[model samples]
Target chain A: MRLEPIANPGLARSAGLPAAAIALTVVVASLLALLAGADPLATLGLILKGAAGSKFALLETLNRATPLIFTGLAVAVAFRAKLWNIGAEAQLYAGALLTVLVGTQLGLPGPVALPLMALAAILAGALTLLGPVLLKTRLGVDEVVTTLLLNFIMLLFISMLLEGPLKDPLGMGWPKSEALPRDARLPRIVDGLRLHWGFGLALICALGTWVIQTRTTLGYEIRATGLNLQGARFAGIPVNAVMVKTALISGGLAALAGFSEVAGLKGNLTLDISPGFGYTGIIVAMLAMLNPLGVVVSAIFVAGIFVGADSMSRAAEVPTYIADILLATALLFMVLAIMLTRFRVVRG
Target chain B: MDLIDILLSASFWAAVIRIASPLIFATMGELICERAGVLNLGIEGIMVAGAFAGWVAVYAGLPLWWGVAVAMLVGMAFGLVHGVLTVPFGLSQHVVGLGITMLATAAAYYAYRIALPEVTTPPRIEPFQPLDMGWLTDIPVVGQALFGQTALTYLALLVALATGLVLYRTPLGLALRAAGENPSAVEAQGLSVTGIRIGAVVVGSGLMAVGGAFLTMSAFSSFFFEMVNGRGWICIALVVFGAWAPGKAVLGALLFAGFDALQIRLQQTGLGAVVPYQVFLMVPYILSILALVLMSRRAEVPAALMTPYNRGER
Candidate 1:
């Protein structure tokens, strides 16, 4: 008997695969939990309970999920167009820097300043990818290398900014920029909870992304370009333009992640603010099967896992990194399941 | 002190070579792997896993060489996972490679927690001693830098030389290159492209692991979280800068290490106060990007670089 990938699968089969993959992830993670001397069932229950068992916990989960929604949507759009924008991490930082500078310097009222901050963030994020995209289009430079390299460079630039010009005088030797004034802060959605209008903004972005991908001519061109670059070019799809547009949109979305963190959560920019939220977006996008609407679900699920893991570590004495293991394993299984959609497994 | 004083110092040169050793080992491996058609983004995690494994070995009272062996084995095992998914399943290389990195990195972190839970200061082991070649180490700037270095530094040079011989001078190397450029063509010639690619990945990852181990076993003597610190990614860039050649890759690693050493020295000498030290830290990454842009147009990348092969399919 031999196994091979099946061609031309239907939607039902595709839908079933991710469910099976999540089940597989649960099993593998259980084995890990067992090895770590914890009861798998209890650990799983604790995780779910920690993330959504109470109103406060659920609020925290959604708060944690807000940035991921933006980042995940960013990744989904880029991957859909076959543009590997690994610089989301850098782009996010770029957005944050721009947002901070604009918000702090402009000193406009809330109505005027918030919109300006968002625009600066989105534009700065998109602009960061311009050099890499242009290089890829013009000279055949690999975007993966350039984008990944930019992440390091942008991070150092952020460090330079914080320690040099941006450092707050009253900050007492901490490496952080000055906090945004009340007019610049995101209006909190729920009083006493960390949830803010950024949560609403994330949902809107996700819905907007879904509409763009499904209903727009640009979406069709992007889909065609990703499916077959040569064929798209042959069909007069303007493949390069599609790639550049996708990069811009993806980079802009990633910047929103940065914006949310600074405006809603942190209130001031620090070197340690992100904690690799941008990179986690790639996993979320993949787990969502690169679908825009699904990005919301996956982002929330991932954020829940992370938040729950921290709680589990404190309450159950489980290692915090156990969450990382489960997430990584889930990522692998999800991809394997997704790829399985391309080919049916048949035994001969 | 002026620029000449720093440039002329034996210790500065020594610092460059010492700092570059890990990159040299990793770049050779990365060059070989890429030449064989698989882009292993798992390099970062593999290096971290290697560092952890080596540290554990030394902590367990094993010799330094034993620790290196264990680290290489861990790397090869991770490579095997990458090979199985990408080679046979025909999965996307980028996703699978990234997944493997995440898995390995998580595993390394978990292992570290289990082994040394909640230590305020990280544990240290006996690091490899410098092999001072008496008369050889006395020659101005080149002497102490080249001759009075750790044995692993010397081994890194040997690995580079051996990689060159294996890649350019051997028939197996030709088959490996052929497998990357055109796997179907290699299969047509009755060589198992799968076998060649898998072997190359396993060996290449093993070498990368050794590079990681060198950081813990020789350079620092302690395994801290994120000690690899994007060195593996830098090695990936260096491979592009080197145009996939082992010899040129050596130069790339040295250039990166030179910047790193210079920055550390400048910071120590209070000269870095004029500009934020981050400016110097940014130099290596920025230079690599510039190198990528300049050389990429002419780079002869293997044709089938990121594609998974399925028999009877185009």
Candidate 2:
């Protein structure tokens, strides 16, 4: 089962399995589209151009990328401790809900209201992660199931809130919450685009996560446990604490993503607030090889594809699902590639 | 309808049966796969694919039975893909399975969008009618609940019994168990671990396909995007509750189905209950985590559950 590995870490290291697989995926996806009568090269060109060709397109890409940065860092942080926190979607929603509830309900001044709302949102997300973390570390239950199942429950809760508790009275019958006070809104950075301070917050979080992951005592213990649990235990690293802490941080970061969406863009929570940012974060983390800084870069790359998908849908008469297909293909290749990076292959 | 009247109605039982039926098929399929030491995480995808393929076939003028058969075939193909990815490719099973689920979901959506015009409403077929046992109608609640269900509902229960017999009483079951529990020892005894597991997954896929087809053809009567919902993941939890036993898994599925049925029923009653529906919606997952935590302490995992088998190693 040992796969081929390239020992050289340099950029010039000639084609490895990861490279080959990624190239294969791009080729295969293009060929598949080409078979459907669309020109492969042209479609790719359209995708690239649609995402980054214009001043507006670049802003659109960054705007789409904002939530991903937070969630990607969320996933990467927890993954470092080998605690798979898959409930980022729920956490994000819960955070958004709390943020909206606070923003709309409390009419505090600009300075105090924003920080309190952000704090409340973070706590809401962290609270959601508590259930899974407790089940995993205390009861030895699999967090994967708990986190995933919680996602549905959280979605249902979100739906219920929009439909019942928080329904806007002014709207014609659509399911959405009341808009937040103007004072609570994040100042927009772009003149004519939706890009705002949330992207900056995500960037800051990524930087913070990078520092925590590479330069802290807790980070050392977390990585130790992830690399080798038994060895970590033998070395007196508190695995349980590290796992819990990682899950909490993961949940908090995801919640902040929710907060950003509410504060920066919408000013109120709505149904379908997230377009699967939480799920996409997993792909982003893996694509980055679980590096925090890499998550920021990969998030931007993925955001470009997403932005591109919308254009492809309008112009090429192709479904926007190509983003998912490409990502899946990239994931498969990257996983194979990353594994190869770890071990060398030879004839038995 | 009055409270007692609603409780005693045939339609109420029918609704319960409809909800329970698909979970039964899927949970049993999951039981077999987990018992064989391969947790096929692609069940969600396979089920959705089956639902779409089954509905499309029926919509395109195929017989109902043939549509179900096509669903099973597609499921097997998906299972084969999963098997090759996990068994041969040696990828992380969870990651591969997750990727497959995402890919299948996206593919299913695109397929639906492409096949049908955006403005056109999707087609729906007449759902399979429940079998009415004319003589057994005299038997009150038992007759209404058991004798008046869809063919798939009965099949699900019968399959559970059949799976139990095969897994617990047959020599084939013993060999399969040995393969999962200790693949190297099974290999030493001249058994093919890969073959047994692949077979298990393929069969499991077929069972899961039936579950999906049941969702479309029997329960809802049409395929929709994200139709399988979270049922596939629920089956993963059910596998733990079942302790890798078919009978136990079926029981767990029934419990979840009952909870689900009750949730819907309660919502419809307009009882104005104080408890949030979301909390109740979380019942299955919450119960599963609680059950797993309790059972895993006392229960046993297959010796080689998550480990990839290397033919010549050890």
Each prediction's whole-model lDDT (CA): 0.87, 0.81
lDDT of 1 by residue, B1-314 (tens): 75667788899999999999999999988888889898988888899899989889989999889999999999999998888777766677777777777788889888787777678798899999999788998998899998899888999999999999988899999999988899989989988877888888899889889999999999998988878878888898899889888989999889878877887788756677677788878877888888888888888888989887776667
TM-score of each: 0.96, 0.93
- Give the per-residue lDDT of model 1 (tens digit) for A65-98: 9988898998899888788887889999998998
Query: Which digits, one per residue and each the tens of the lDDT, describe model 2 over residues A1-108?
Result: 334445665543334666787788779668656645677888888888989999888888998899999889988888777788778999999999999988888888
Poorest 10 consecutive residues by lDDT, candidate 1 chain B: B267-276
Show how many residue pairs clash in every candidate, following the order shown. Answer: 3, 0
Per-residue lDDT tens digits for candidate 2, residues B115-146, read 66463556789877778889785576557777
DockQ of all predictions against the true structure, Cα-based: 0.64, 0.55
Error of 2 at B243 (Å): 1.5
Q: In terms of DockQ, which candidate is strongest? A: 1
Candidate 2 runs further than 4 Å off: A1-15, A31-37, A343-348, B1-7, B270-296, B311-314
Off by over 4 Å in 1: A1-16, A345-348, B268-271
Top candidate by TM-score? 1
